[model samples]
Target: MEYKTILVEKRDGIATITLNRPEKLNAVNVDMRLEFLNALDELEIDDNVRVVIVTGAGRAFCAGADISTFESDPARIRRNLVNLKREPRRILSFEKPIIGAVNGVAAGEGSQWLLQFDLMVASEKATIAWPATSLGMACPYGMIRLASEVGRFRAKEALMTSKFLTAEEAYQWGLVSKVVPHEKLMDAAIELADQIKRMPPISIRTIKEAVNRGLEGYEYTYQAAVNQQLSDDFKEGVQA
Candidate 1:
């Protein structure tokens, strides 16, 4: 399938998915979300591609959701919400390590995407922000991932205060695995991918599965989705 908002490139054992909408700092809209997932789906099935790198095309990695694309049509909104209920975490359901090559600012949903990645390599200049509360919105996914990564106290503070984390801060918080110069972000991510590629594939997959199994609590994010879906703040956020 042709993708309008993302680029999928395969080479050696690496498949790179580049978010292509730099105009809006790779803010995910309907088309981008669909195409991004489609790209990951293809990579997942390809045995030759043992590792995947997700990055943005331009300066910023991802600025978050495209608020302008929030559906004003009630039917469309309801349909979307219903779909979310079914597939709340349907981004990249792949076994291979998906490395986040964070090149720049990753905010809101961008930060959420960062959390979902198996490993994150952030550029020194990259900034991570979960300012959803400040925007009259809330990121249930980010908060849940935060509690899973860090402790509950830090998650509560970060979410409630709309704390914007620099690359160093993200590393300190154990959000990203590595931090490198802006020019070396992709290089670092690729290096990590290659390093992991040498391990026995089956063993790697098993290890990943075990780690994910321990985080079964993420399933509770579905409840958070429902809570946010029915919230007045979410409505105001979409409208704003």
Candidate 2:
């Protein structure tokens, strides 16, 4: 399917989804969110697609949600938050492996989405952080995912203080699986996807399902918070 904010290309059992709004740092808007969901749905059922990679068009992967949307209509604040809460989980729960190719800075909600990927390849020039607290909003999912990726204390510092970590540091902290030179980010991601394509698809799907089942209770809680964030406080924070 054609998309306005994203470009989807599939080849050799690999599907690459590029966030196309580079001028705005590929920030998530309503259209982008819906298109992304649709693209994922398509990829999930495609028999030829064995792995999926998500990246951005230019320097940044995604800076965050588009603040301009909230500026125009306060109600969009809740809408954006709800989208963030749901989409990442959907990507995480997908049966096929999903890889994150972090080409540059991935901040705010973008950083949160990175945690959902099964594997990650980040450029050496990339940086990741969550600046939600600085914007006067709580990032419950970010906090939980960050802690799970790194450690509790470090995640707290990163989220509360909005500290950005270099790609090397992220890899060292176990946040990203691999760190390569900026130009090699996509190549590394594609290489990994190729390796996954060579593996038995049924085994990969079963392992993913079992792992997800192990976290069934936690997933439900996360989804609930994602839905509950569609509240006045979240809207106010987005408007701010």
Number of the top-ranking candidate, with lDDT as the measure: 2
lDDT of model 1 at position 216:
56
Kindly provide the TM-score of model 2 when superposed on the true structure, using C-alpha atoms: 0.87
Those runs of model 1 whose alpha carbons end farther than 4 Å from true positions after fitting are 73-75, 82-88, 214-220, 227-230, 238-240
lDDT of 1 at 83: 48
**Alpha-carbon TM-score of each model against the true structure:** 0.90, 0.87
Positional deviation of residue 227's Cα in model 2 after best superposition, in angstroms: 12
Write the residue-wise lDDT of candidate 1 on 1-240 in tens digits.
Answer: 679999888888998889999999999888887777677778778889998898998889999888887765556766765544333255434678788999999987778887778899999999988887875656756767778888999998898898888999999999899899899888899899999988998988887666655445555665665566566777886677
Judged by TM-score, which candidate is best?
1
**Model 2 bad stretches (over 4 Å):** 71-80, 213-240
Candidate 2 residues 1-240, lDDT tens each? Answer: 779999999999999999999999999888998998889999999999999999999889999877776543446544555666677578767889999999988987688778777888999989998887665565647766677768889988898898889999999999888999888888999999999999999999888766544333445545554544455665566666
